[model samples]
Target: MPGQLTLQGKVSAGVESGCLVMESGGKQYLLVGGDPAVVKPGAEVEVRGVLKPDLASFCQQGEPLEVSSAKGR
Candidate 1:
């Protein structure tokens, strides 16, 4: 049920390839293999993915919405 929710946040850190750090609602989350367009630090994003059981991983297999452009929506 957690993955069914859409989370809005800003990219805080673009770490190594396929790994990114984001801050959502005051909480920090690590998203892997995320779209680079939305992984840029300070970039706003709408993530639609499932949170792993570890609670440290956010898997984004679907498309992500980058705040850089309103067209992505």
Candidate 2:
């Protein structure tokens, strides 16, 4: 997890695409994994994870993050 990063933002669950998204430092990231029950729409969250650019996703709006941890902030 050398390249892992910590991100804090308000989560937005894509209604149509079914992806969890977080915006931090003006950048958007498509979130994956973590505490699913905690990652929800309009919730403040702090996540520790690494980016996976090659990961294919139906919701292609943001960079994909393989989440290591996610918790309510």
> TM-score for each prediction?
0.54, 0.92
Worst 10 residues of 2 by lDDT: 13-22
The sequence of per-residue lDDT tens digits that candidate 1 reaches over residues 1-73 is 4345456776655444454666667666665445565456677777766555354333333223222221112
Query: What residue runs in model 2 are displaced by over 4 Å at the alpha carbon?
Result: none
User: Best by lDDT, which number?
Assistant: 2
C-alpha local distance difference test of each model: 0.51, 0.89
Q: Which stretches of model 1 miss by more than 4 angstroms?
A: 14-18, 55-73
Candidate 2 structure quality by residue, lDDT tens digits, 3-52: 99999999998644668998999999999888878888888999999999
Candidate 1, pairs of clashing residues: none
**What's the CA error at residue 44 for candidate 1, in Å?**
0.9
